[model samples]
Target: MTFTAAALIAASIAPSISNAAVKSEGMKVSMQLAPTADARQQVLTQSAVQFSKEMRRLWIEHILWTGSYIVSAISGLEDQQQVLSRLLRNQQDIGNLFKPYYGDAVGNQLTTLLQQHIMLAGKVVDAAKAGNTADLNKYNAEWHKNADDIARFLAAANPSWGFKWLQDMLYTHLKLITDQVVARLKKDWEGDIHAIDQNEAHMLQFADVLSDGIVKQFPKQFQQ
Candidate 1:
């Protein structure tokens, strides 16, 4: 699932609108231009695989990295600013993927909501670090609510997102995220490792579902 610059740049392989010269902007997108339909399919498959792989790497690694900082909470543990930067970068990557299909406004809005998701997860980690069960419950609920917002937002945008499935998938993402944080707090290395594996694997499925939905929803974008 390795994605080269060419693979990504060219992976917006969807047919152009009226054969217009293709281009992209931040969080905006279009489809790939392949030699043939089969080539296009291969490109899309690679795109989905790469999308999932990068997503899992970025997000799961984010949890592990940030969780380390939270658990330690010692001076000079790690650069907090750098952590935030990485989070933003990961999200921006996602927004860029969506931009072509959703356009700039929608893409930016999606990124904003997703940013809220990241902030909420940070809050959960903060609550866990404080050992405040009440706060943890509160923030956890908020985090879940954010997931619902994400679900509704996406489902409203594209029926292919499937409200129930997307909601469940998002919740699973949150739950596994919690698993990692809680395990870190409790020093449960086995549980943490297990959650990491689960989170990465499940997220790939989500990626596939998302890619499938996009392909189905906008057939012209992917099909000639």
Candidate 2:
């Protein structure tokens, strides 16, 4: 698990900034290129603390939204609104994490966009609970649109500070959830197999988006 966590953390860093320059800086800066094992452990420990704090906030939103549509909740999802509420809380949880990377304005803007998405997604959950497929589709469309808007902001920022490795980790986690969601829903309902297949394909597409972003922005990291 720590290896997985570390991989995710490593992936987020902005790919060695400027291979030759960063390497040169890294060498010349000499903040302590060599450290005792204890010192290295301490650094890793601090990194893990910060990483876990951010990841946990992400986990909260993931659990709330994704869990809402899980098979168990299909019958009577009274907590549909609660899921959105949890999302707001999750937003606050990760507020500080964003500040170090994006400062106040961008961080707040991103948070606002995320909250809007949560509100729209909440409507989808509400529609689903009511068995209103048409309304669910409408809300889903809005949700996707919001997602696209958020992606644009992220792309504009291009957050090169190794933040993307975390995205790969997140994408991997999302893939797992999508796989389970499709399998569980298929078993629990008689929905079209084609829909499940499409959903799975979409998950792959999303992963590709993340991968493409990483490779395009940080080709050197890929080489490494």
Best by lDDT: 1
Please give, for residues 1-224, the per-residue lDDT of candidate 1 as tens digits: 12221122121211112132123222111223211123124445454555545555655554555455444442234676576667766666676677777799888888888888887777666655655556666766677778789889888887656566667667656656665665565556787677777666666556655665665565566543
Question: Residue-wise lDDT of candidate 2 within 1-224, one digit each (tens)?
Answer: 12332223223222312221112321221222221123212222344444444444464444544554443344455764565466576655545445555578877887787677556644653454454546755765565556556656665665421233333333333333333333333353333233344334433433333334434444343342
lDDT of all the models against the reference? Answer: 0.58, 0.44
Ten-residue segment with the worst summed lDDT in candidate 1? 9-18
Q: Lowest summed-lDDT stretch of 10 residues in model 2?
A: 18-27
Candidate 2 residue runs with Cα over 4 Å from true position:
1-49, 64-83, 159-224
